[model samples]
Target: MNAGYVRLSRDDDKRNYTSIENQKLIITQFAAENNLIIDRWYEDDGISGYKFDRPGFHQLMADLDKDIDQVLVKDFSRLGRHNARVLLLLDEFQERGKRLIVIDDHYDSMQTEDDTIGIKTWYNEKYVKDTSQKIKRAIGARQKAGTLMIRPPFGYTRSHKDKSEIEIVPEEANYIKTIYSLYLQGSGYRMIAGYLTGNQIPTPSMARHAQDFAKGVISKHKIAIQWSDSMVRDILGNDFYTGTLRLQKRARSTVHGKDKRVPKSKQYVFENHHPAIVDKASFDLVQELKKKRIKSNYRSSHAQPAQPELSSPFGSCLFCKDCGSRLTPIRRPASGRERKYYICTTYNTKGRLHCSKAHLIEEETLMNDLIAYMKLCRNSLCKDITAYNLECTGDEKKTSVRKQTELQSRIDVLKKQMQILFTQKIRDLANAHGCEKVINESYDAMQKEILTQICESEKQLKTLRNSILTDTDKKERSQSALQITDRIIEMKTLDRRDIEILVKKITVDKDGLPEIELRYGLSHLIPCSPSCHLNRQENEIIYQCMNLILQSDRDYTSARYLSRALTDIHYPKSAKGVLPYIGLMLKAGILSQGSSPQKPYIINKNRFEIKKVMDTFIKNCCLV
Candidate 1:
């Protein structure tokens, strides 16, 4: 039977023309025209098409019981717009003996007339990326022009004359102010969210009341409702609450037209955009307080409850005490129950496999170490700050003057280059002749390099601003010292949430002794890997994944499964980010996957050689 799939990216509000009903209609017409029977229609409404984790899409793929002959979509983009994901899905379909037909794009399942699917796909991918860049530029341009790109937030309303200008919404503004005040006084996020919901205060989205808002031609009325935890968190996280207009907190995907939250480094933060809802001092304090809160409950040592980590937790941490090879996690089936243990990654390999086997650390130990480390880090900031201030930073003025001048100089140069590049890009477009591909590539490469340089310079400037002029001793002595107080309170309890915020890295020495690194509210001290501190059980699992990849089939699904399982063990690190390394592993025959036109995957192997290599790398015996 033929199936249809429809996906509306997160940023692309589907309540408009891209609604399920409308998509069904479009696909139904196309299917009828082609005399194809519609077996099932899969819809991932309001989900980003950048990743293949959408609920409906996964279900469609996993529906092995049902006989699916072909899959149809409005465009290949509906399956996924990301180049990696799109190609994999297409390949997967072919593997499964199921064909895919994208109607709107004229990509037929049976047709190989042009035989340029790969090139066309690349073009489509580039188009998506180019479109995203254009959108960002547009937003940046408006922001530079002093025009507001977002709504006036919950408490404020847009001025009648100027859409960019913000005016307080009188009653709502007062309520919002009260909320801020209450939060500063120690009201938690959930409590505040509950309070607003209980009082029936309209959420920011609800207050918009756009009865005929245009998402596209076909529109629908979506009733906005009360505030939720997520909404409250978003509001609280906004630097604009402190009278700063920080634009570009989120970015649109080039391929999917979906929104993903950008790292703080990429944001275009302009101070004093609008009237402050809360003072800068108070806003900063709130941010600090939020950091002290930690979530402790975890099913595995590698799991992080709420936030993404900057570095891998498990990288360069696990090692075998006996052989000095990294201990890899091993799974054993005993009495119908699965138990995890650690073995030398090279234990069962050729050439004197070393180390007497050791028993696995229980899951409980994993939880204990993670929670304890988290608590220690969250609680140490104030003390560390105190210690750091006393020991270092005798020459503040010298650093400040030097940094400020350098930043200003760099900014001036970048602005001049940016202007030239803008003009050059226009010229390139207008004069598209003589190896257009080569010309475009050259221009794009230059643009990318320029943007990267500008971004780095901007980051250095931000760092300088945060430090330099501020007197650590005087600041600490004068106002209710935010650092010392937070540290004392958080460390005492060692709460799970507190630990999550404070602990940066946990490294395990050769003797199974774990070392925890604290962030100390400073960027410089952050460790690259924390999971190194995890016991042997965790490392074993990572080793297993490496072995599975080396021995099994090479495919996205296989790698994803390995990633998921390893995550459950203690490699809470993401495999997706290390795609190049993974690809390398596949090429080296250290990792392998089963061949399937659709859903290629890595299989579990009962060997320790793969784990040994990974262990050596983690222990720094082998460089990454």
Candidate 2:
């Protein structure tokens, strides 16, 4: 049996002679002239010759060892532009007792010895490489001029007046806005996707198909109304909806004919290139929220909430104090009832040898503890609003006006240098007799250095500007903290948003005690007034002893254990030396004496007076 192969690429489509139909016609005429019958045809349309993974070519190879004894093509280039692969194919045919024929190159394996096949293949590959370079240069030129034509994003359509411009499709734009709104309102990607699909809204591809159908263009493809999380995420991440044109994100690889992603720094961006569907501020905020969600491991971005009411407010904020791993929530059947508990993820996955214990605590217990802590903080803030204001005011530093002016001047100078370099490049290009390449290369290197310096200067300037907060900023922050704490105290139950706004982390110890770290340094505010007359050194010793006892796995710790722990941490206290502090704590009702003398120290942290003394000592030591 004989096999005929034909291929046409986008570059070849411009030439009438290289068209698929024309190539097939040429092969048929040659076969007829030679009295050879062609039994099967393999066609690869609009695929690059540099690629070897064409479906039609794959099918042809599968039959080559079975029914086909000969292969025919219009030319060797039709087989492939990859020189090594084309030459190997020719050799394989010769060794397999099969005949091969090329009509345009006038080559026949059975009748002629063509030693120039390698040279011909090499020339074909070189032609492809040169054509690829020319296309890239043309595209780059257009991109630099901001006139490169690209497909409009999901919420837009090509303008009739200007092919390079895009106009927002109102219906699709509304859907885009809805997606952003839902995401900002604490909806994950999958939830948003389900909502859209449930509402019978068309997907991006389906919308395009409907538009074509309205114009009387018939298609046999089925348009499904299903939306996927990935589709929704893509829409949310696309900056084009913010009136920005971000192009050159992907470039074709010349060797493999595959698209490779270009780095963001290398991609071209033109702001305000079109009307926006979503405002820039909202879009930027969504991006920041997405990043925070990912870093926190809050939930699977693609997962829909199983039960909204059952969702834990501590989502990803809960952790094990010992292992520093997230506490995964689980529902278990206990005493014929369902109980929700959070356990150390490390202990559950890696076993007890890796983590000391499960660090398990009931969800209700965590909620109550967190609320109580917030209330304590609120009370402390209320007791001395002036003191709270003073503490928070020191948190922000006033930027040096002289340094900011220096950064601004440096940035301006660098930008001016870049402009001068660009002008010099243009002047050299226009006046150069034969040194244009050298001139442009030198100018580009200099421009890149200047741009990097400008970027650093601008970042420093932004930091300085942000650090120079006014008195009003401090007052607003203090007020915000008070309001959030008040809400926490009044709410019946906490939700995910509330947790995200108020808490940074909640680390649980082996004894199921939670230590909450409030967001925005709210935890730094002392929760009780320090009326104790202890000196700084004495206060530090007390604080360390209390922390050691509370963090211990055992209920009771002796003075020897506390001394060793403190010494290992550079406190350098002997067992005899720590006994004095322990006695003082016991006298102050912070530590209780154990029943046995072997382990006589007990830290009853649940006692109200103990908590008060500890808080006072913590304030004196500045350990808050």
Candidate 3:
């Protein structure tokens, strides 16, 4: 059987002479003229010749030893541009007793000596390398002139007048503004994404496709209508929304190599190059908030927490004053009741050798203390806004600046060391030290370690730079904190989002007292306050109802069962009367309803709010 192989890459498509159709025509005509019939056809379209692992090529190779007695191509370049691989493939053909034919080069294996095949393969490889370099130079020239062709970002489209420039798409720009607005209003990436998805807003990809469909450029296809946290994060982090053109941030080292991220110092950033969707100040503020959140949530240990979704409001805010480590939440079962508490992470993981005290504080008690502190601050601010100074201290700024300088200097030193090691490795390879394999392996390991350190140091430096707040930023943050404090006081509950906006850290001392640090430099030691006391009669009623539900053996206790149980206990009430208490318990997160509407309720043992309400009632009141 005779096999005809056809291939055409992007470079080949530039000229009609090397098109797939043209190659097929030439091969078919040559076979007909030679009175030979081609039985199998293998074609790889728009694939690089430098890559030998293409599907069409693999199929052709698989049949070489079985059905294929002859392989034909228009030229050797069509088979491959990889010099070594192509030479080895030619040898493979000879060893397998297969006849080879290249019409363009006028080569037939059965009739030719093929002494110049090696040189021809090398020239083919050189052509590809030269073409790659030429294309890169052209792109470089365009980039320097701000005329490089690029796909526009989500909220933009290429200008009709000048394809090199971008203009805002009004509908898409509105979504971009909404994302930034929600982020500044203390919405997390996931929360913002959920909001957009719930609102049925089209994602960037969907919107782009819709435009193309409307223009009749492509047929309509099904696309997912969803938004992801990563999409939200990308939009929020893009300085392009602020009318900046950031380009050349990624490039390939070799023609066939994967693209690598270019360092910030090497990227081209042109400010005010297009219409703005978000202001520079707001963008900077969002970046600062993102950095703070990342720093707070980062844990030294790689292990994930057991219940991340059920994490306390103070998860990121709580810390230990003694060891200066973030506190971790733990749940303990006590007499059939589960209670949540926060302890110093250092003491919990390590022993007394690292930290002397647990600094244990109940979740309920911490919430009460934090609420009281917020109330006190709100009262103080209401009386006189200037009562407490919120200006950042000079010493803190100086220390941060010093640290930034040190990190930058360290990064510079690491880069120099990396260059030196690379030079040393080259010299060793050239000199053929002790064993070639051992020398290469040792240098490769060292190179990997140094590269890892350099990446880590660069990341730390970027985070530090983002964390540094300017004077304008401090003033704005202080005013925003005041507003957030008022809102939290009015709600009388602190959620995770509220904590992220208002508090920087809550440091608990060895005595288990928390010091509240506000975001804009306000710090206070929360004064001890009386525990919340509920009405005795109401507490008794709640206790009786909760006890009945807990004592029930069934997984789900219906409201009717609770009414009957209460009557048997001499506290008679109809199911309708029991509904009120059930509603309150559900609202407090102490009880959860089943998935189906007909199913009853189940106790929520893991909720921290349950412990607060239950313990307070159990201490002050007895069963009714």
Candidate 4:
């Protein structure tokens, strides 16, 4: 059996010799001429010649297990551009006692003895490397010049008049705008992709080409590709929709020459080259969301402790109106001991209350007030949203005048260009191509330019339509968000899990009133007063103990042991029995697990104070 191989390095070159039909024709002719029966055909279309990893290449290797007689190619270049790969394949053929032939080169593996051919092969290898480098250089130059280089970005098509200008692709451009608008509205990347698929919009890669082949518009059809989250994310992150081009966001190695994407900081960006679908404000909003997503991803990867679920709807709704600190819930013992309440986070890290006043609020009364306020906010938002939507519809008349002026200007330019091209054709005064040729070129340019203008007008119309929908949608969504917040708040009690969905931050005031801030702008004020407060002298003494804990000769295990002991002092009488068990663990060395825990524990002589300060210095940046 004779097998044939083919490859085209410059991608575009494949259009000539590497076509499926051409490969089949060459393989069949070579097989018949050599009287070699073929068993099967292998093909790898659009595969690079520089890489050995290819679909058809694997099939060919697998076929070697069969009783193959020889391998044939139109030329040696079909095998590979790499010299080492060619040499390895040649040695493999020799070991198998199989012959290789390149009909175009008139070379046969069976002959095997030519010093001149060896030099030619070396030269061919150099040629391949040189050609690859030249192509890379050309692409780099185009990128630096701010031209649309390889692929026209999503929502745009390369301009026929000047390949550098990327004209808006109407259908795709509207979809791109929708993606950005939705993203700013808190819809995520995957949601935007789902929306596109749900709307049955043709993905950018598969859209119909506006080119006309009969009039010699490039005779190529675009292949349809499916919508994916990756595609949506790329569009959302791209600055192209904002009329800016960001270049050189990648680098090729100086040694191995493998290209690696350069970091975002290295990218060269120029703004306002084309019309912007997303303004700077919306783009910045999207960026903030992106940052939040990045932070969330990082947190998830580290597996941070799960947030506690809120027990009452109103429980998590309360915050310190003064310092914005969350009021931590403190439950009393089962023995009917008095309930205690306090805040979460250090109120004063530097032994000063100049920045914040620590406030502690009782939990029971806070929830009732929060629930009442939420009901009020919900009704208010509903009323305001309805009023805003009505006002927005009243402004529709303003756009008609602007649209008429734009359309008139575009029509006038198109008519003038058509007349000039026709006049040039009749004059026959050009030095180079005669009037006919000049006229034909000018006519083609005019048609394409006119088409581009029409596409722009259509895009503007779409924008006008979208703008009408936007104000109403914004009001509706805002009302919906407030309603969701109200629902979260209306719950009499909440657990930590419920709180995570609605509450972002909680703060306690000096008066111990907890003011809850909802995720969607619903605010509620409540009375969350603390049961007790240690005097300034007492807190200072505790601070002194903390300093001692840090200066102690004890290790972490021993110090943490002492810290837990001090924290347990606030426990009620019924839970007091558990303290002995803790003490037993300390004595048995189980608390520190046979290691000293003394480093984190502190004891002070003044005010009979005891406290624990863990050694949590994060790389010399000590944080409380």
Give Cα-based local distance difference scores for all models.
Answer: 0.58, 0.75, 0.74, 0.55
Ranking by lDDT: 2, 3, 1, 4
- Cα lDDT tens digits, model 4, 429-527, are 454463566666766765665555555444444544444324644564445444555556766664433454455545556645444455544333222
lDDT of 3: 0.74
In model 4, what lDDT does residue 581 have?
A: 33
State which candidate has the highest TM-score: 2
The residue ranges of model 4 lying beyond 4 angstroms of the native Cα positions read 1-48, 54-57, 102-111, 150-178, 191-228, 250-259, 296-624
Model 2 C-alpha lDDT per residue in residues 537-568, reported as the tens digit of each score: 34666777777766667767788888899889
* RMSD of candidates 1 onward, in order: 25.2, 12.9, 16.9, 16.4
Best candidate, lDDT-wise?
2
- Scanning candidate 2 in windows of ten residues, the lowest lDDT window is 528-537
The reply for model 1, stretches above 4 Å from the true place, is 1-65, 68-94, 98-114, 144-146, 180-239, 252-266, 281-624
Compared with the true structure, what per-residue lDDT tens digits does model 3 show for residues 423-471? 9988888989568899889998777766665665565556556644456
Better of 2 and 4 by TM-score: 2
lDDT of 2: 0.75
Kindly report which residue pairs in candidate 3 clash with one another.
none
